[model samples]
Target: SFHHYETPEDIRSKTMEWIEDFHADTERNATLWTMEKLSKHDGSDPENYPAHVCVMEFVVQVGADTRTFPSWKGHCVTRRNLVHFRGLSIDKNDIRWNEDGFRPLPDLACCLEKEKEYLLQNLETLLHRGGRIVARLKEHLEDQDQSRYTLP
Candidate 1:
């Protein structure tokens, strides 16, 4: 249902653009606006339903332990069926549509979390601040062969 609104390539392009914009600006984080239809996929009156557009904000920051992390956090404020707008924090990872008595959409929350991870991977390449030590360690490990075969 969600793919009907935004394709995977669309998501990737938008995410990459955001990262690039943030890197160039260096003053403000990148903001992305995406809309996903909160439907049960019953295929009834899909066009008549209005989806609550979500606004997500992201920033790349280094932790105290010197690990790079993407601080991608935002809330989904959705107006249900032309009514008043209601919201749930994406940071919570458990979205409960209590206003309309709709059950929690774990998939939606999971998708949002996955976007954050994707942004982190993008940041690793853009910022190159994930940690030199870790990168070196990974390189060292990869350089060594782990084959269990014994040569004659």
Candidate 2:
């Protein structure tokens, strides 16, 4: 599934192998993917609603169970060898709320890889938007500074 930028075939294949190995590990199932990272916020919108979809990953988890329901630990990476971003927190309690844990490695690997593909495809667009946001934020701060009275 080639997309906007061409990754060398060796890199792609090697990356998948590493992902599969990590997934199959009994002690660690580390995956990297992009999602509409969100956090519960008590903002003007709502007291306990997920915040907006920024390009940044909030270490948020999203999954579904094949038996009863599923759960996940989340991490995001945008490229072949680099971790995209790391957040301040994770679901620290190991929330497997389905009465039993049921995560098949192959399926989980596919799910993670798919999300990674989606992120890779849109990476350019997202980066442009982020740049625009930064420019706008700088302007906003400057405006606020001008409005404040300076002590002589």
Candidate 3:
């Protein structure tokens, strides 16, 4: 069997589309969807709880054991991609648990592409919201800067 992964550009474009859509909802957008780039350490920090959605690939495998519930020895190649978001930092040691904020992306390439065409048509609206967007982005960067150093 063969699998196909979207190019980084495609993935990024789709992610942006989802974010832009989320931003369109004025009431909901107030919550702030920070972080444009993906991170391995994402969702692991207490300060950054509820990180917005991002895509990542995970490989799962099960041991072959007939007596146990439908076990297999080899890696499970299917359904490797996921839409990760809304993470919580409960236990620092358990990364899997901390980053469990996800939903299986059946088609990784299309997960966030549903409104691409529609968003393209409404680009003007998004552009008009630039002020809010810029403010939020500035806040995000400033937060990063402040968090990098200890004031004490």
Candidate 4:
């Protein structure tokens, strides 16, 4: 899970704490082991078949206070790309334990594209808001200068 903060420093501390807690949790101890295995098997040609299929999960939380401020704006982005098993050959392909061995699915590409689009839309909105705030601030500064200084 990702939690946003008004300042980057605050979020950095929280992120470190979360990492430490995750490492200490016994129930979640296997998370890093699984990730390492996945990394080693990813894109490996002629794989005998991974013992277990892995599904990566992500969570994000955007703080309310940081959402509106121009200077303190923050974003939480997650990207997931589908895994394709084009080279791996398997015998007796069957779904067990609610998990299927690595195999290419036609719909996976479409789903990934949709997710990418959603993230892009969110980033675009943030940029738009930042631009608007900057323009308003510039106008305010100009107005202040006009009122404070007379023609000399």
Q: Which candidate should be chosen as best, given lDDT against the real structure?
A: 1
Give Cα distance to truth, residue 59, candidate 1, Å: 11
lDDT of 1 by residue, 3-107 (tens): 212335755575566556655664342222221222221123335531111222222222224422222111122211111111334344333233332222112
Tens digits of per-residue lDDT for model 3, 1-152:
23333335654575466557656867645543223322222334424431222212211111112121111111111122111111223233212221442112233234345323322323222233231121132222333323232111
The candidate that wins on TM-score is 2
Expressed as tens digits, the lDDT of each residue in 1-152 for candidate 4 is 33322335654465445545545665553333322232332222214422221222211122222243221111111111111122122223322121442212122233444443443334333333332111111111223323242111
TM-score for each model: 0.21, 0.24, 0.23, 0.21
For model 3, how big is the CA root-mean-square deviation?
Answer: 17.0
Q: What are the candidates' C-alpha RMSDs? A: 19.4, 19.4, 17.0, 23.4
Clashes of 4: 0
Order candidates by TM-score, high to low: 2, 3, 1, 4
**Candidate 1 overall lDDT versus native:** 0.29
Better of 1 and 4 by lDDT: 1
lDDT comparison, 1 vs 2, better candidate: 1
Cα distance off (Å), candidate 1, residue 129: 32
